[model samples]
Target: MKINEYNVVAIEYSLKDANTNEQLDTNVGGKPLEFITGMGQIIKGLEAEILKMTVGDKADVMVAPADGYGEYNDQAVQVLPKEQFAGIDLVQGMTLYGTSEEGDTVQVTVTNFDDNEVTIDYNHPMAGKTLMFTVSILDAREATDQEMATGVVGGVASGGCCGGGSCGSSGGHSHGHSHGEGECCGGENHKHGGQGHGGCGCH
Candidate 1:
């Protein structure tokens, strides 16, 4: 059937950085990436293209940074004095959680460091980079009543593709109770996933 909202579609895709050709994510030899269409379960740019594809279709799609993750925010980067970091051992490429201005937890990545200061960036890891994907739809079908009701894509019975319960993974958002097969936060509002990669299990 043609892909549509509330439909489940499985795709075998390899995601890469458009500039550096770095593989960012993939689900080909493993559980094929699946989501419910019409739902914002993935990047907006990719979702728009998936809407027009049919099963067995193949395409190499590119998404701008704004449409994929987003542009890096300079304001999000803060170089704090060495004194700001205490107790924790600092590393060059480690991710650490910090409380935001509003008391929300934000993940910060250690980007650079000096003797008296450390630079951490709170931007989404993929921010500022274009994404490219080689995709082939493996399967597509209408979602089940329960699946649609729950807004979940690959559940236990579907041999869950994204093993992580949190789709937010390394993104700026949190999965709540979701793994990589992200659902709406708390699975309450599956309509919008979040900032960049949003949605429930709607492929």
Candidate 2:
């Protein structure tokens, strides 16, 4: 079937940072990545490119930050009192996984910390970068009833970004389907879909 809206697509892909040439994530020899097309289960740029492809097709697509994970939000960075993180040792470049005020599974980095205050950045770790994807479409098929209703193929789940034991994650690299407000954790089904805020990067 053509890979249109509501179709389930399976693909093998490798994601990399365009500038650094560092491989961010890949699902090549493992299980092929799968998601419902037009459901926001993947990033906008990648999905748009996939929309133009068919089964067994191969392509290399470059995604801008705005259409990929998304541009970094300066306002999302906040400087607050350190008391908010009592008992935890504060350090620069530390990623913390915890629940937000809305009780969502989230990861934030410790940008700076002082005796009186701390700076937290809620932007996606890969927020502002051009993403390069080498992808091959394996198959495309109709979505099942359950997948259509929940908007995900797998059951809802969560993980941490760095080392958030509170999130019950061994390491913080894995993520789930809910990224607070915006962004879908697309790769390997580890993160959330960016339905509200536009799709962002996934692990």
Candidate 3:
């Protein structure tokens, strides 16, 4: 069937930095990445291209930074007292997780630090770079009523792709979750995966 809004689709893809040609993430020989269409589960640019394909189709899709993770903002950088991250061995260029004032889980990178202060960048690690996703659609089907209601491929608690971290394994987004590196898929309650390449994951 033609892929449509709210359809659950599974894809196997390899993501790369379009300019540098650096492979950022892939699920080639791994589990298929799956999500519901028009639900904001993956980057819009990639999704737009995916909607044009059918099961067993393959394509190379390009996603501008704005449509993916967004452009990097200098204002997103902030210097906080070192005490804010006490006890952890801070490493420059490493991603870290923290809670925002609204209690939302946020991810930041250690850009610079010293004995008294730490400079963190709130921009996603992949921000500002265009991305290329070489994708193969494995499956696509209309979502059931329960799936649509829960915004998951399956009904709530039925353990959709996000629950297994397949869709978000380095790239995809829904809400309250960043797919860069090892960020969790399901939001505040899920455990972050091991740090991988910088990219978005379905979360």
Model 3, range 1-203, lDDT digits (tens) per residue? 67889888988888788999987777688767667787766767777888888888989898897677777777777777787665567667666655554444556667899999888776666778788888889999998888777765554333223222333322222334434322232232222222221221112
Off by over 4 Å in 3: 155-203
- lDDT for model 3, please: 0.63
**TM-scores for candidates 1 onward, in order:** 0.68, 0.71, 0.75
Candidate 1 per-residue lDDT, tens place, 67-111, comes to 765677776666777766655576676655544444344445678
Q: Please provide, for model 2 over 1-203, each residue's C-alpha lDDT reduced to its tens digit, 9 standing for 90 to 100.
A: 45688787888888788999988777678766667777776777888998999888999999998776567777667677777767666667766665454444555667888899878776666778788989899999888888787766553432211111222321344334343211244332323232221111111
Better of 1 and 2 by lDDT: 2
Better of 1 and 3 by TM-score: 3
Clash totals for all models, in order?
A: 16, 11, 9
Q: Model 3, poorest ten-residue lDDT window?
A: 194-203
Question: lDDT of all predictions, in order shown?
Answer: 0.60, 0.62, 0.63
Q: Give the TM-score of candidate 3.
A: 0.75
Whole-structure CA lDDT of model 1: 0.60
**Top lDDT model:** 3
